[model samples]
Target chain A: MNITKVLDAKGLACPMPIVKTKKAINEIESGQILEIHATDKGAKNDLTAWANSGGHELIKHEEENDVFKFWIKKG
Target chain B: MTDKKKTTIVLFSGDYDKAMAAYIIANGAAAYDHEVTIFHTFWGLNALRKDENIPVEKGFMEKMFAKMMPRGADKMGLSNMNFAGFGPKMIKDVMKKHNAIPLPQLIEMAQEQDVKLVACTMTMDLLGLKQEELIDNIEYAGVAAYLADAEDGNVNLFI
Candidate 1:
């Protein structure tokens, strides 16, 4: 899948990761995909809930080397 | 009417940590496109206060209160482990080390996100807090206004 933008939120705590993700998603047009890399454990659930609540779709997410990566399609 | 989800929080504590929690949730909800409101009442009004002295005229009791309460969110004490006001300092230092967003910036972010920040009029009167002493661009209202926003709210919390 083609990625429109990438947000590096590694080492950030709760709310910042999601906060940065929201801001990043708004920069792209609807249907575009946003890639986010974060280290906060809570970002998994938080980003999922955030994407759902904002009408966006968390198409895929994966954890590698203690970094969580998420691909979200903006709605 | 728009079908936006709503989150309303009644900020009733003067503690720094509690206020931080309230703002974190508020900002997160706002980021999720939820209409958010934080109603500042009782000691919670301190979070909205201006840091500098405003030099407002007041009665004796009001003056006493003004002197006793922390001037703003930055000066607020913690609800737990507040060892003679040293806990806030420790927590702030730790937060800085962790790259955590501080309380003042969180409040600013909320305002920028258009989160409706309302100061309870009744509590403001009781605390002798004048609008001039609070930050700009915030609404002033009582419990009825809070209820109006909270009645249909998807998440309603009293913090």
Candidate 2:
């Protein structure tokens, strides 16, 4: 069974959220989802580029009241 | 994907001229198609500040000392480094004379090349600086944050 993990990356900046999300994703099997909660505005762009470069799937990315949520489905 | 190598540079040199070597190297790496991330820390963090002054060598002896020194900025480590203490102002002047582009322009070029410039948050707090005090349009992060991005196949180095 695939597992999903929610990584609270809020308050983390730039590369941190991306790095932590990647680590969390690595702990799971392929096809699992790693949900990253980040606050840095740069993540909106940086994460997308990172996911693309790493060959992972970014399933969803949304912002709610200054909080950013990114869902990555591990490859 | 072609599996191009990724690299992360940790800059801790605060001396103006010394820090330039890292900035130059980071941009050079990206220019060659390598993905680059620079985590500015400690004295190195000043290089990212918008209002930070480019230090100058004072007095005749200080100037003579600078002229005789190897570029300390490049000494931050790793190979392919050397500098004469003329410092960042002199370095900038020399580059400008050669039409080598300005630091701000270089920064823009780095961004255009997708180089990641990460300002260290802890250093910022210790210095009592605000995010607005840094160069416009760069990102900020803690050590854990930088390590995360650097964890996957990126050549990590302390510059």
lDDT of 2 by residue, B92-131 (tens): 6666564444545555656766788898988766655556
* Pairs with backbone N, CA or C atoms under 3 Å apart (clashes), candidate 1: none
TM-score leader: 1
Question: Model 2 residue B60 lDDT?
Answer: 65
Give the runs in model 1 whose Cα sits over 4 Å from its true position.
none
Best by DockQ: 1
Clashes of each: 0, 7
Compared with the true structure, the alpha-carbon lDDT of candidate 2 equals 0.65
Model 1 lDDT on a 0 to 1 scale: 0.94
List the global CA lDDT of all models.
0.94, 0.65
In the order shown, the candidates' Cα RMSDs to the true structure are: 1.0, 14.8
Candidate 1 residue-wise lDDT at B119: 97
Among the numbered candidates, top lDDT falls to 1
